[model samples]
Target: MNKELQKLLRQINDKKNEVKSLVNDGKLDKARAAKEELKALQEKFDLLFDLDEEEHEGIEDKVSRGTAKVIGGEKADKKNLVKSFVNIIKAGFLHVEPDEADVKVYKDALTSDATPNDEGQQGIGVTIPEDIRTDIIELRRSSDNLEQYVNVEGVTTKTGTRNIEVDAESTPFDNVDEAADFPEMDEPVFEPIEYKVKKKGGILKMTAELLEDTAANIMAYINKWIAKKTKATRNAMILKVLNTMTVGKEVVVSNLDSLKDIFNEQLDPAVAATSIVITNQSGFNFLDKLKDSDGNYILQKDPTLQTKGKLLFGEYPIVKLSKKTLKSKQILAEDGTTVTGYKHPVFCGDLKEAITLFDRNVLTIDINDKGSGMWEKDLTGIKVRDRFDVQPVDKGAVIKGEITEVVNG
Candidate 1:
């Protein structure tokens, strides 16, 4: 199957170049014929790549709670509460001496589930107040991969295992006749993915002057930093899991011709109908350069244009990552020369079915205004932690393409 697809793509690319040259030389008739041939080949490729959603039951439907869309519902007002909390924390760090009412506002924002301190106060160690937790969660959701691809679950406990049914039922349904033999029934395979809370944090050093500058939008600055660090940490972990998944299909493409083959093959018809091609910005830039022999861009923009700025390769949406993210492992040329840069991996398929993420949902923060050694320096320490794991449940749904510099042209 791969060999056939590869051959077909090479033919298209070759024909495209030929048609362009023919038209440039005023051979309109020849160009038209070649264009017709290209059209036929494209139709065939599309047929092979078109996945029937009814035939392939998505793994997410089996056990996914959908991606988290924080900052909605009855808790909409929590958005402001979160900002208020940040302001209170900023005051503490700067010794700004906020009013008694301000302290109460920050404390009151703690989550209901927060373990009370000895003084029966809300939350532990200046942790993100409950109302503000939504903001943090929403920020984490901004991770390029986490919210888009992974099956995000909001779990309550810090340590636990997610029991997932890995396999579909093996029995075939058959019509029964009077006293017909019964078909054998099989149970789905269940597996547990254990997740532990991992700590990720950063300390912001505020100058006494900046802290004391009441006019400064310190809350916004702190919030942006919090969101940035949170996404970086969580997305890194998500990438780790995705890059290692047992891809159901893979193709090595050294040139545009072969790249198209791999791209088509990755769109498995057995998976869900909605699919996305994941690549970094550099990889997308390479794709952007792909042109038909007629000098028209081969990559099509999404016709509907309602995909939140997602471009399309045929019907599949492309999710562009930041530069260097989604990188392929190092490669060596056939002549034994080392490939200098990363061959960014182009991941494509029904990501919702391909990856599962277990999120503990709670962002725990521990603040130390006076650590044993820090008291002397008057440094305030903020520690944040969250629990989550990204795992592949249906590896067959994903296809990977390791793209190197050779494919750029």
Candidate 2:
């Protein structure tokens, strides 16, 4: 590389570091300005390089070519990326330089802009590959993750509004005489629900000794930790929205008739057809043991080949969460005394219509070795940030009820 190009590259790197610092301090405006300057420097470097227009050789393209050449004309796999990621993390923690291949992959995976979302800026770090992110998501889904049941919308901005029909099922088309003057119909009402993305994250502190382990082991540990934390955080937010919905009717744990009332009487036929039952472990136990007059279990195995699970009332799919995930609440008893109630909430309805999860689809990690006591303790703080929000849509679509008995205070 020419001296001029090398100088421009150094300038670009310095500008990137500046932008990252500004973003970390929540100075988005300044970070954006610095990013613009970095872009100009990059364009200047590109012009000086004088690459072929047909190839369109950008920095990432050059990095990929170099990586390919260094790896003996072989494509870099997930293992390579994983090792590179671990090396980058170690380099950040130890204040040392990473391997050439590691740096190449890291640069190749770099996002175009440091601050993708204006409202919530990501910290300084390497963005993991898409496959690794997919792995984390898959791990979350392996358990009782509530995201699978609700409607999830990927949003770019931090805040937005969604217009939903007032009553989609009731709004029917009017029939008029052919070629005749059409009668005026009532306008369908739409309610706009605004959603603002919230940042949820935590620091995963690791001992320096763990950095000596194999890259695959380090990757597995990190992926599992992130998946568990993100899943629990999202589940809590989703349940908070679910709790806001008014209960249409109370359900008796031993009474099958009362449980059936939610679907038969409380919910519309259209809604009942697509409704599902979500409850905690205690609630599931009660429903799972319930039998009809003929002594046949109400919850039957799903017969369809496409779906595999036990269906409640031979129709509605049932999802059971752990007690830790779905916590209990304290309620006032009839005697005017406080009681700890294990109100195992059993929610039944079309969850997709009831709630929407606006996912920013951005997960970032920043490593800090100089943070409080890190140098002395030889620990690295890995901060993970996930952006998303949960909001209620049609509150009437879902009905909430308790199955567990309350204890006296």
Q: Which candidate number would show the highest lDDT if scored against the true structure?
A: 2
Tens digits of per-residue lDDT, candidate 2, 53-169, equal: 433344346567764334432446788878877887777675554454565565455443232222332223555656678889989984378998899997656687888989867
Q: What do the candidate models score in CA lDDT, each in turn?
A: 0.58, 0.75
How high is the lDDT of residue 316 in model 1?
Answer: 72
Compared with the true structure, the alpha-carbon lDDT of candidate 2 equals 0.75
Once fitted onto the true fold, the runs of candidate 1 whose alpha carbons sit more than 4 angstroms away are: 1-108, 115-124, 137-145, 167-172, 177-184, 213-216, 247-250, 255-267, 292-295, 304-310, 332-342, 368-381, 406-409
Model 2 residue pairs with clashes: none
Weakest lDDT window of 10 consecutive positions for candidate 1: 115-124
**Tens digit per residue, CA lDDT, model 1, 1-409:** 2335435544654566567657755789998998999899867865653443431233224324442122222342554555555555665454454333333345345432332132421222344655555555565564274565767765444456666676453435767789988766566677777766564566654444445544336545555667777777777877776677844445664656765664455445556366677788777777778876788675786777655544544667777778755565665656667565556677767777777776655555544455455556665565555556666667767777766664331
TM-score of 1: 0.64
Could you tally the backbone clashes for each prediction? 2, 0
Model 2, which residues run further than 4 Å from truth? 1-76, 96-104, 110-124, 247-254, 304-308, 330-341, 404-409
